[model samples]
Target chain A: MTIENYVILRNKKLTEKTFELTIDAPELARLSEPGQFCNIKVSGELIPLLRRPFSISQVSGTEVTFMIAVTGTGTGILAKKQTGDELNVLGPLGKGFGIDDTFETAILIAGGIGVAPFPFLINKLKEQGKEIILFNGARNSAELIKLNFENELNSTDDGSAGLKGNVIDLLHANRKLFVNKNVKVFGCGPHPMLKALQDYCSTGNLNCEISVESNMACGFGICQGCPVHSASEDKYYLICKDGPVFNSRDIIL
Target chain B: MSELDFTVKIGNKLTLKNPVMLASGTVGYGNEISEFLDLSEIGAIVTKSISLKPRKGNPPQRVVETTGGMLNAIGLANVGVEKFISEKLPFLEKVNSTLICNIAASSVEEYTECVKILDKYKIIKGFEINVSCPNVKDGGLIFGNNLEAVAGITEKVRVVTEKPVIIKLSPNVSNIAEFAKVAKERGADAVSAINTLVGTAFDIYTRRPKIKNITGGLSGPAIKPVALAKVFEISRNVDIPIIGIGGISKWEDAIEFMIAGASAFQLGTINFVNPKAAKEILEGVKNYCLQNNIKEISGLTGSYEL
Candidate 1:
C-alpha cells in the first residue's frame, strides 16, 4: 500500500466523457497489482470530501494510469486536469485476481470503463505464456476503448459493432470458447454485466473471478461502507479488502 | 522542543497515551488498518459495535455520499461477541493502544451478557456502550433516545465490567445533555457525544430514497457544528469526561472540541479520506500546546470563554 501526491504526466480524452490519466508515481507504479485500485483525492475542497476509487488502469516504468469516465463531479475534475498538476492517490489497495498458470485459456470480459484494469492483467497473463481471449463491450462502438490485443472480441449495445447486445450476449454467442477446454473467466464491468457473467459461469461450472464496483469511501477496510454479501456465509465482505475481485461462487454480487 | 502532556484520564481508571482515537465502526479490530499506520500512535482503537448475536446488517445501497459528508446505514453488522473474541481479538491484543470494545444489543439482558463475555479479555481497557446506532432494528436509537433506557443499559453493563464505561449517545434526541447527565449518574466514566444524526437523501432522477434503509446516520464535516453544540451543552451540565466525536478532520477541530469540553477526540469519516488523519492531528495537537506555551494538551479542555 502506497500514498503519494503524483504529478499528472498525461491526461488524454478518449471519448467525450472518458479519459486516460497518467501520473508520475514510481512507488505506486512498482507496487500496484492487477485488479487493485487507487483512492484519489478529487479536489482540494471539502464539499466532495471523500476520495474516489479508481482501478490501476495501467502501470508503466514510473507512471500509474487510470481510465476514468467523467460521470460525476469527482471524475469531471480529474478528467479536466492539466499535465503537471498534483493529485493525491492512495493505492494499489485491495486484492487482485488470483493469476496462476493452472488454466489454459483466460477469457477476459470487460464492459465500458471496466476495461481499465485489463491492460495490466493482459501483460501479466501473457508473461506467464497463457492464451488469452479478450471480450470488450460498450454502449456503442464510439464508447469502446482501443486495445492492442490481436484476439479482441467486440460488442456494442446497439448493432454498431461485432455483437448487437452487451458483453453477456457476446459471451453467450461464443459458447464454444469455454467448452472442452481448461478455461477460467475474468470479468469487470457494470453490476448488471458482472451479474450476468456470474450467472453464466455458475451454470457452466466454469471458474470465474470478477472485479466488482461499489460506493467505496475508503479503499482500505476501515470505513465498512462498501459491502457485498458473501454467498457461502451470513456475513458481508468489504469490496476494498476482501476483494474488488472475488470468485464468482463466493459472493452474492 | 518543550515536553507536552497528551495523556487523558477517563473517569478515575484508564489513561490514554494521546487524545486521538479512531471512532467505532470506522476502523475494524485495529488489524485491518494497522498496515496503513502504527496502531500505538492512536490513543485508542474503538472496535465496531458487536451484538449478542450476529447481524447481517441493512441490505445493499447502505452508503451514499452527500454534500460534505456521507450517510451510512451499516446496522452494526458484526461477527457476534463469541466469534469476535475468537477471530478479531487476537490481533487487537497485540496493539499497544488502549482498546475499547464497543457493544450493542437489542435488550438490556443481552447488553450485560455481552459485557460479561468481554470482561475476561485483559487487553480490553474499556467498554463503549453503543446505544446510538440508527440503522439497527430494536436496540440502537430506541435505547439511546429515551433517558430511562439509557440509564438502565449503562447501569447493567457497569456492574459486569471493572473497565471504564463510556456511553455513546445519539444526537437525534431532544436534549443530548439530559442523557449525558444520566450516564454520569450511572457510573459511566465518560460520554461520546453525537453519534451520526439521523438523516436521509434521495435520488432525484429515480424519485426514490438514496439508501435502502430509507434513513441512515449522517457523518463527516457536515455534522461538526451540530456535534459541537451538543458537546458544549453536555460539558456545561455533566461532570464526567467527554470524548468528542463527529467531523473532527483536523487539529483545529480537535482543539475546538477540547475547548468546548471534550478531553479526547475521535476521527471517523476523515479516516476514509486520509488514513493518517489521527497521527497528523496528534502531531498538530502537540505543536499547538508547545506553541501556546501550554504544558499539557488537557489545558484546552473547557477553555472556551463566554
Candidate 2:
C-alpha cells in the first residue's frame, strides 16, 4: 500500500544525529513488511527536491515510524520536521525479509542505526514464536536504540558499551551461539559490516539473508538508480525493487 | 460555473483527456509507480527512451540532487525494442492514459528500425523522437543539433508510422527555433522542447566529477526558465503544437508554458520529488479553468500579449 502526504504524528531525537519520525499512514502500516522502506519528501521546496528512503522501523495501527540518521541536507531537514507537520510519503516499497516458520532461530545483526529495521522484524519473528538473538553495534551507547530483547548483545566502537568492538567482531567472538541450532541469519548495517557477516556465513556454509542499501531517487524500480551487483547474474539488481533484502549468497555484497 | 474543456488533440492523430503528461524517463514504463499513483490522472505516459539494442546505462551515481534540480546520465538504459514490446507494452496497455513511446538511437537507421518494430503495436498512441540525450556516445545530441540529421530522422519516422510524431529538441543549440523549423518542415506533429541542458557537477573535496559520465543533463526548476524561453521561440517559429517540458512543478508553471504558446506540458524532474505532481497539476489546471471562466484550455495557448 502507498500513502502520500501523510502527517507526522511524532518526530523526536533519539541521539544527536539519529532521530525517529512516526507518520499517520494506516494503509502503509497495515501492508508494510519487515525490511521494506518508505520514501519521504524532505521539504516542500525544490532545492531538496528528491525524497529520501528510510527503512520501516516500527508500526502501530495508523502510525508508521522510521529511524533516521541525519546524514546530509535531506535528512537534516527531515529530522527537523515537527508533529502535525504534513509530509509526502510513498512506502512499503522493495522486497522485504523472508520470515517464516522454516528457521527455528533468527539471529539478527545490526550496525549503528542499521538497528532501525530490526525492531519490527523482531516483533514479527517473536509473534511467529521464533528464538530471537539480536547482535547490535554502534559508535557508542548513546547511539544504540533501546529495545526489549532478552537475548540481545551489543558492541560499541568507543568501548563505551557492552562489547568493545564492532558488531562483526562480537559475532566472531561468539561463534558458538550459532553452532548447532537451526538458525537463519538476518543482517542490516554499514557495507563493511554486511560484507563481514556475508564472509562469516558463507565460510561456515550457513544460511543467511541481508538488507542492502544504495543511493536511490525513486524507491521503486524506475530510475534504476540504486543497483547492487548480482552474484549469479551478470546484470545489476535494483536495491529499491528487487530487494533491500536478499540471500547472503545471492548478492556480491 | 460552466464546465471547462480539458481535452486536447495532438497532431490530429491523438486526443488526450488532458494536456499534462508525465515526461519520459522521469516516470518509468507506466508500471513502476502504479502503486503510488493513478495512471488515469495523467494525459499520457511517455516511456523511457528505448533503442534498437539493450543498454546497461551508466554506472552508479546515475542521479544526484542539485540545488533546485538534479542531474542524470542514465545513458538510455533499456530492455531494447523487442523486450519493451513483450514486457513493458503489456503493462502500459493497462494504463488509462494515452501511451507515447520515446525512441532513441545512435543513427538514423537505428531509429527507423526501432520504430518500425514499434509501429506494429496499436497500443502506442504516438511516438516521441528522442534526439536530445547527451549521455550517449554518438547520434543523440548530434542528430538533434544538425538540421539535416534532424530532418532525416523525422522524415524517416514520419514515413513509417501514421501515429503522431513529436520531436524532442535539445536546449544546448545556439538558435533552437532553426531546429524546430527543420522538424516542422520534415513532418513532425508537435515539438517537446528543451531536453536537459548539458552540465557537470563536481565534489570539491575529492576533486572528482559527481556523475560518472563526467557530464550529464540538468533538469528541474533550475532549467525551467530556459525551457519556457525555448518553447516560446519554437512556438513562434512553427505552427505545430509545442509540449513544454522542464522544471514544471505546479499548475501555475503549466499555465506559464500554456500562455507562452505551449499547447500542453510535461512534468519531468518534479516527479522524483513528488510522484503525484502530474496528477495534482492536471487537477490544478482544471480548477484554474473553472475559476477563470475559460471555455477551453487551448484558448490559453499563445494567449500571451505584449
Candidate 3:
C-alpha cells in the first residue's frame, strides 16, 4: 500500500535476452531480503495498464537489483533503458527465500535462468561452509548459465560443456555424491525441471526448496493474483504474497 | 464561456462543473485515490461497478500489462446497491461533487433492482450502466455487442431513474456507431464510449499464461486509438453527447477524446501510477482551455474531423 518512486540507476545486460536492472529504491532495498520482488513501471506511456513484477535478485544498500528477461514489449523496453532514467518501481514485495545455518552440506540446483536465486542465496549460505553441491542445467551449451557455481560445487550444461543432459539428470546419473545425506536444495527454472527435481527429492529423500512463478499483480499480496497450490494446507496461496519461494513439499507444483 | 462560468453538459441534462471526470471501476467510490488526493476537484467521481447483489469479484490475477496498456478481469467487486446507498451514498453526499453510480447487472431483473436501490439516494445525480464489464464470463459481451441488448439495458435503467442515464459502450462490437444510435433511440441521456478492450499477456519463459484468468480487458494508452475511434464513430452518428475513455493518462489524450467528439473525459489505470494524477490533469485541462482560447469547454468537443 506504500507508494514510493525509484529511478533506474543502472541497467546492465547479463545476457542477450536478459538484463540486470538496478533501481534507486532505498526503502525497498533496506527492507528487501532474499525472496522478495518488486512491481515495476514498464513505461511512462499509459497504454500498458499494469506494472510488471520481478524478483529482487540482489539488494545492496539503496539499489534493488532485478534480473529481467526481455520477453515482451514491456520488458524489451526495460532492457533498452539506459542509465539515469527513472523507473517507477514498487518494492521488496512478496515473500522471499529464508536461510538457516543449521545444515552444513547444501546442494543448489538451477534450471536455465532459474539460476537467479542461488547466487545471492549461496553467498549467504557460504559463511556456513556447507559443502554446497550445484546442479545447473541449460538448453544447449549456447544458453549455459554464465555464473560460476558459487563455490565451484559442480557445473553441468545440457549440451555437454562441463557435463551432459540436465542438472537433475547429471545428479541421478552420479548418485554417489547424494547418498542418503540430508542436503538442502533450492531450485528455480522451467516447471518441468522443478517438477522432476521435486519428484527426485521425494524419492531420494533430499530436503529441497523451490521457487514458483504465477500471475503477479500487486507483488505485495494486495491483489492476490499469483496463486500457487499449498500442498500442506491444500489451499491456493498467492505466489506474490505468500511466496515466489516455497519448500519442495509445500506446493503441488 | 470562460473557466469561472463554464459548465459542460454531456447528453442532455448531465451538467458537470468541468469536462473531465474519473472513469468507472478504477477510482473505487473516489475514496481509493482521495486518501492521498481530494475527490472534489475532479468533474465527477465514477465509483466501481455496483451490481444489485454483492459480488465477490474475479479470482486473483485480475490484471496484467500488455504492450501499451494493461488488461483486467476484475468482476465487479462491490458492496452491493443497498449497502452502497446506505453506507457509501451518505459519504458521497458530503462531497461537493456529483455521484455517477456505475452499475452492472447480469439480468434485467438485477439491473432494475440496482436502479430501484440507487433511486432513493439524492446524491446520485447520474447513472453509468456498466453493461461493459469485461471480467465476467459472457457477462460484458452479452449486453454490450448487440445493439438491441445495449438499447434494452439502456431503456431498462432509463425508465427507473429520472436522472441522466449514461450507457457505457464496450469496444468489442464490430460497429460502435450502430450501438450508440440504438442507445440514443432507446432513451439514453448520453453515452460513454469504449470501455476496456479485450486482450491478454503471458510469460514466454514460463511457457504459461501471464494472468491466471487467461484473458482480460486491455486498458490504458494501448486502447486510446480504439477508444478515440469508438468516440469518433459514436459522436458522428448519435445525437447525444459522447464521453470518451480508454488509456487516457495525459492532457493530450484527453484533448484527443474531445476532438473525437467527446464532450467530457475520464481517467483509468493512470490512477495506479500516481494517486494525484487526476487533480493535476484537471488543472491541466483548465489551463489548456484557457491557453487555447476555448471560450466554452464543450466547444472543444468533436473538433477533429475526418
Best model number under TM-score: 1
Q: Candidate 3, DockQ to 2 decimals?
A: 0.21
Tens digits of per-residue lDDT for model 3, B1-306: 534445789766788888778887666676545555666767888888888777666655667766666677766767788788778776667766678988888887788788887877777888888888777875577888777788788888778889888889889888988888888898988889888887777877897766667778887777888888889888787778888888788888888899989988988767765556677787777788788787777788888756
Q: Considering every candidate listed, which one attains the maximal DockQ?
A: 1
Candidate 3's residue-wise lDDT over A1-253, tens digit each?
A: 3456667888887767887888777777678766666778777665454677776777676777788777777788888888888887766566666667466677777777787666666666765666777777777666665666544333445355656667777777767776766667778877898899899999977787788876554455433345566787635666766778888888887
Q: Model 3 chain B, poorest ten-residue lDDT window?
A: B30-39
lDDT of 1 by residue, B1-306 (tens): 557787887678989988898999888777767877799878999999988888878877888899889999988888899899999888877767679999989999999999999988898999999999999888899999999999999898889988899999999998999999999898898999879989999988998998899999999999999999999999998787999998998899999999999989899989888888888898898888888898988788999999
DockQ per model, Cα: 0.73, 0.58, 0.21
Please, what are the lDDT tens digits per residue for candidate 2 over residues A17-58? 898999888889899999999888887787787888899999
Expressed as tens digits, the lDDT of each residue in B1-306 for candidate 2 is 557788887778878888988898988797866765788777888999999998878777677778888888888888899899889888877766578999999988898898899988888889999999998888889887888899899999999988899999999999998888888899999989979999999999999988889888999899889999998998887788899998998889999999988888898887776777787888889889888889998889988897
DockQ, candidate no. 1: 0.73
Best by lDDT: 1
Q: Candidate 2: which stretches are off by over 4 Å?
A: A146-148, B1-3, B36-38
Interface RMSD of each: 1.3, 1.4, 4.5
Return the TM-score for each candidate structure. Answer: 0.97, 0.94, 0.74
Q: Higher DockQ: candidate 1 or 2?
A: 1
Judged by lDDT relative to the true structure, which candidate is superior, 1 or 2? 1
